[model samples]
Target: MKNLLIGTAVLAMTAGAALAQDVVRLGTEGAYPPYNFLDDNGEVAGFERFLGDELCKRAELTCEWVTNDWDSIIPNLVSGNYDAIIAGMSITPEREEVVAFTQNYTPPSPSSYVGTSDGIDPTTAVIAAQTGTIRAAHVSTMEGATLVEFPSPDETVAAVMGGEADLTLADKDFLIPAVEESGGALVFVGDDIPLGGGIGMAFRQSDPELRDKFDAAVQSMKDDGTLNEMILEHLGANSPTF
Candidate 1:
């Protein structure tokens, strides 16, 4: 697990990077595989990383990857710890009050649940989700659910694996891969729940210009079919398009 770093120490460094104007800091939680994760070489790798680099390249911007714990991502961005957040962050009205988001690169993904077996009960189950995520917020609203949140998604997975949680909820893209990796250890349970709109790049409220640049790049990718290609490559061809 990564320690939460939300102090001013990182802010100075981030502000300096922003001041440079030539380089755009792309913030992400590297723990979420298939969205953003450390590759075999221990560098940022996965769909969003690939898409982010392409967006920066098309926008004629130099990009730097910055990894941070998910719980404090927004505050750290507001504090100038990074220029923009490119993690698998979903767009929602509540979040709009805090930051501006670029156009979505992927369509809304279904939030699904998984358990050690097929017989889990959502009405009384202790469900694990990553703290500060849309999944956590949505889970909290579930009428009979008991949300057991963790600082990270990996820990949420651990909660289910260790019997600490009866089930866990996450994007189908994430849960499907986890289930496949689990062999017969885990199984999907309950209907797929629709949550937020889609995934977007987040920026400080005052940074509309930066958001616009990314928005344009994302649009270009969609128009040329490159965005769908990337999504299909990582998320399967049946994956939803923007």
Candidate 2:
């Protein structure tokens, strides 16, 4: 899960302003795998792709996928570039003030620290996190730790690998594969830190009807056990379910 305060420049639209549009655009950051990413053919693919498609079908809405950079994903949604944000965005009070969020699609996930070795103390180490993420905010508040931010998640991992930072904090799911493939170069350090409420679809505050539709669709998936199955399939067996 991740969080960042909304900027002041965004102005909310009136109710129903975007809901009347014919095609609903689902925005996502195509870089985060398992959640959402680009396939070899450059199409959006992964857990969210499947989930969003099913949601559209269940809601009886014609939808299209749109990829946006992670940092600007929310702003673009607010700017009407898309109708909804299905990026692995965490539910946080700071963000809720700007955009309306549907019921969460995924439960709270733990954030972990990945480093070159096991003995390093994350509390005082130079920690790297993607800019605008909850992990970065958490690191900044640690009394002795130094927070280094990068524009992308991949660069956060690279910082630790290159010795630019003592550790990188990110979603446990996102780091697990990287650590596994590192061949012992990277290991999890410190306790797993839980952050944010959960993952959800975000819509403009004015688009309550559209938000409600997706919320019902998400609830339908949960009620039928399909969401849980998809969670286990894409997020590993240990992943939390509805």
Candidate 3:
């Protein structure tokens, strides 16, 4: 009887340790480039990939990547589809109410309007924005503009190019490459609009311990200046850093 009780206690302790070290799945939208995206090899790659890996290392946590569509990313997180969101998710009051967020990793970026031609008045033009993004929310508030929603960021750009919409509003970092590749086919149509509090990792409100672990990891990167270097490398020198 004594031996059996000792073996049972040992087993319980081992199980607890295993549960503590369970793999943390980092969720992201694989379509968003320079943030999180699938490479030619179909593996997750880019800035967020690099950042998430480093954070997991610093926190001594086992981690893996999982992709979900942008429209359903938050809902999926809430439903326990993954442990945390490492996609380029901006911190906003509306979002904070649903999921807890780590400190800002990247500084607030300006949202810009891109159109096929210059001098297009964005105030009254038909504007395309990715559905469920802060940019789309902002566009909806524009009194004279018509807001057209698309399921993906690429589709929002296509809406402007295909004449489905006069312009598209999105993160300047994401649009810069598209405009450059367009070879004058696309131009900045209006002033850049700043929105959101910056990008951060998000976890379910129930996972405060997990959130704190990653938050400390993020702060360590910022303190060491590595995060700033990464921001300049992946997002361009013009991007604001920690």
Candidate 4:
């Protein structure tokens, strides 16, 4: 009888430990606002963060958040540093070769930016954003438009406001804080800008089960208004129409 009781207790303890283990390690560029960003309290807060949290709960698994530089996110995921990526990373056919993608949470929107300068004439000066962003890609192809490539969106905004570049192109989502942080030195060109592709989570090519679980969770969030509430919290009164 004592042996039976001991065996049951051991099994219970083992089961509890297994249940407590985190099932997924989600990586993100915690600097991207409205998508994923760190709050004043040093907690990761954003639309994507909430979605990731919910997905873990829905799948009955533990989820741990990890920070990774945006440029290296995919490589780290591929190397098993994390089980999945929840960055505001866009899903593209190019990336599909290396990793599978969950259904898009943030659909693609046109990349936009604000241009500013004190003394320099916009007609004569070069305006640009960082290299490799869709904005830089588009700006570089314009006739006579010298697109200055900076290291990051923040740098590009500095260049433009400091008269280094006439302007910078960034995702509309990013442009909001950049302008606010710039102390009114910059302004969006117009509200009529057309946007581009959607953003989705990245996973290992061999992990379709995880991807499916995430996709279903996202759909549930979408249907239940959880995703929208998170969007409103991060984006202010004028939340993006998801």
Candidate 5:
């Protein structure tokens, strides 16, 4: 009878494992590239794709990619629309109150500055950031400059390009593409300060099991060189670090 009971328990555990292997949906902004963005053909590509693939591999699970607006991704994850979020979000104390984080995937801090003219030094000019974003808080504390808050990064970038705001601040990865796309109308000008010290997978705070699993998978990838390889592939060899 004891052996039969053990057999039943084993079967139940196997069934549970099988149930856990169902389609795990991942959320990304699909707006930021080299991290998570849509290609010309509208297919998902970039660091987020590579990282998500590694996580699914580590967890031995199948996944479906889902595009979401930047602000809605976390709320949707909390609402159970997806299993996890990998949208180049930084781990912060306030965010920790609402969601849990996996291991640090990319290098923690990566900041950059953009100005209308190549001759304008960002540190000495007035800066703008999207309101209600981490970047807004980051730029608001500059010692000798003023921070103009906007509704979006695009607006901040546009302000600089259109000669409204003197500069704009954002994660270097995001800033680079904007600067390049501006065709020298806007130039990057910052002191290469380390901004985000810990980038990680975000999960609802209630989902500790899922968080732990994702965290373990991130650590496994880090141990196996997959994370760094993806970073190098996107950010290049000369990328700044903290």
Candidate 6:
């Protein structure tokens, strides 16, 4: 549902670059639908799954998928559990301090405020955001808003639906699917807030060589318009492409 993540602050952990191997493991939080998530078949399936597969194909690398919780995804990567993270992770200063990011695969999409018809005043309303995300960081800065943090994007939305929060802030792309599927249960309120940089693949900083390989593949996809095409197919024609 986000590049919005859930976690505590972490210190950067360094490791040696992955040695040449037969298969490169790709890590993702297999819970955020439309980006990466388990399908009805119980296999990883979604936009990032397809994108990651295409990237592996173009880079001529043997790859496999590994699911991880959002809170520990980065740490796992640092511990060498996976070669890279293709989850919907935004490139941010705090995150950058811990891991290296590829050139953005998706440009920064709009962040939306979703709530009932009742207008929410940032000055006093209770707001829910996923922990460790830019949205949570934003809400924390509000002068008077009561901030509630959850471990996943779904939990943040649940907080609003369950009446624990007055409203929630999250990716517009993720919320649109819910709003349309909800049949009027949710509606957009307030102006769209654009937060952080675009979504990118994350890797250990020591793996710049590996990062370079994927970066070239991403650039090729962008150059041939394949990246934007995938974005349209998954996120919709109206969604802005890189």
Q: What is the lDDT of residue 196 in candidate 3?
A: 98
Cα lDDT listed for each candidate: 0.85, 0.89, 0.87, 0.70, 0.73, 0.83
For candidate 4, lDDT tens digit of each residue in 127-207? 767554556666766776677787566777778767787767677777887777767677776443454467788876656
TM-score of 4: 0.78
| Candidate 5 structure quality by residue, lDDT tens digits, 134-202 | 777777776777888775567788888777788888877778878878776778774766765568888
TM-scores of the models, in the order given: 0.91, 0.94, 0.91, 0.78, 0.81, 0.91
User: What is the C-alpha local distance difference test score of candidate 3?
Assistant: 0.87
Off by over 4 Å in 6: 1-16
Better of 4 and 5 by lDDT: 5
lDDT of 6 by residue, 1-242 (tens): 12222211221233334537788899999888788889888899999999999998988888999999888788788767888999999889888877889999999988888877547765688998887778888889998898899888888888888899988888888888877886788788889898989999998777777788889999999999999999999988777897
lDDT of 2 by residue, 39-144 (tens): 9999999999999999999999999999998888877877778999998888998788778999999999999999998899987899999988788888999999
In candidate 1, what residue range of length 10 has the lowest lDDT sum? 1-10
Better of 2 and 6 by TM-score: 2
Give me the overall lDDT of model 4. 0.70
**Pairs of colliding residues, candidate 3:** none
- Over 1-242, each residue of candidate 1 has an lDDT whose tens digit, in order, gives 12223333334344334535767888899999789999888899999999999999998889999999988888888777789999999999877767789988899989888999888888788999999888898879889989999998878888999999999998889878889899789899989988898999998766667788889999999999999989999987667986
Q: C-alpha displacement of 5 in model 1, angstroms?
A: 19
Q: Rank the candidates by lDDT, best first.
A: 2, 3, 1, 6, 5, 4
RMSD of each: 4.1, 2.7, 8.8, 10.9, 9.1, 4.2
Model 6 scores what on Cα lDDT? Answer: 0.83
